[model samples]
Target: MEEKKSNGLAIASLVLGILSIVIFIFLSFIGLSWIGLILGIVGIVLSVMAKKKNPTGMATAGLVLSIIGTVLCAMALIACIACVGALGQTAETTRDILTTIY
Candidate 1:
């Protein structure tokens, strides 16, 4: 009889990594970017752990995707925060007029 090994963690990591990218792109506009960022971080950790246990192409790809997703989500979050912070700062007259007109 042959023994079978499970790749559950690697699979989960891949799933979460892909979801992180998808969510970061589609749901970030609605303030769900944090969720994606969290997912990416979790995926990265899982993928790393999975690699240590049983390195696989899926695990490697998962780690890469998770990193990309994390970066994108972090950038979005930072940009949103900066925009909000800037809202409290003084605005030029022309820019303010344009903003108010919208």
Candidate 2:
């Protein structure tokens, strides 16, 4: 039987997964939500590739973390968008009020 050799893809997946978590944390603290989104996507791709090459517990963990990162990033994105929209509405309302008063 031929033995399969482990490749760097697995390592890459692990590194990317860790990076995704770090990026998520940084974004959460600093309000740079887009960085988390990008890192999560990259982590997910690396994890999937690693799993395809060789199934391992690390790869599985990477996959789970990648999914969580992606979801959190997406939620942040939605919240940011909603906040901006609300701000715009509020600004317009304030403008209307000022014009009416003037």
Candidate 3:
């Protein structure tokens, strides 16, 4: 009887996908979205590799989760950058106003 070998890549992909989602949820606001985004990208690559190596439900799930995480992280990162830019403009405007008033 031949035994099926475990897919380590699939397992890693799943774990990384899950971690990416969790990190994005907890730290996205603090500009940690890049970390989650990187993790999600890596998970996506691993999942694709795993799928190519051995088709499995785990790999599919990992791909889905990684995609979701990557999207969320990207959105969060954009929002943070927008917010920073807005604040900077506001500060500069305030400084100008104060200088004119003085």
Candidate 4:
């Protein structure tokens, strides 16, 4: 009887995908979303290759999770940037108002 070997890339993709999501959820706000985003992208590429070589549940999960993590990380990063920009603008406006009143 021949046994089928599981794909390693698929496993790595799954782990990386999960890690990406965890990082996004826990550490995304501290300018660390890039790590998760990169991991997700790499996982996605690995998962696609793994699917072509040996399609499995792990590969599918990895692909889906990687996509989701990537999107969330991107969104978080954009939100953080926008928030910073807004804070800066608000600070400048407040300073201007205070200066004018004094």
Q: Which pairs clash (backbone N, Cα, C closer than 3 Å) in model 2?
A: none
lDDT score of residue 80 within candidate 3: 36
**Against the true structure, whose lDDT is highest?**
4
Please give, for residues 1-102, the per-residue lDDT of candidate 3 as tens digits: 111332777788788888889989999877799999999999999889888878899889988998888988888876432344544567676677668755
Model 4 C-alpha lDDT per residue in residues 18-70, reported as the tens digit of each score:
99999999998687999999999999998898888888898899899999999
| Candidate 2 overall lDDT versus native | 0.69
Worst 10 residues of 4 by lDDT: 79-88
lDDT measured at residue 98 in model 1 versus the true structure, 0 to 100: 63
Kindly report which residue stretches of model 4 are placed more than 4 angstroms away from their true locations once superposed. 1-6, 79-102
For model 2, what is the alpha-carbon lDDT of residue 31?
71
> For residues 10-84, could you state the per-residue lDDT of candidate 1 as single tens digits?
788888899999999899989798999999999999888888888889889889999998889988887432254
Which lDDT values do the candidates have, in the order given?
0.81, 0.69, 0.81, 0.84
On the 0 to 100 scale, the lDDT of residue 91 in model 2 is 68
RMSD of each: 6.9, 7.3, 7.6, 7.9
TM-score of 4: 0.70
Q: What's model 3's overall lDDT?
A: 0.81
How does each model score on TM-score? Answer: 0.70, 0.62, 0.70, 0.70
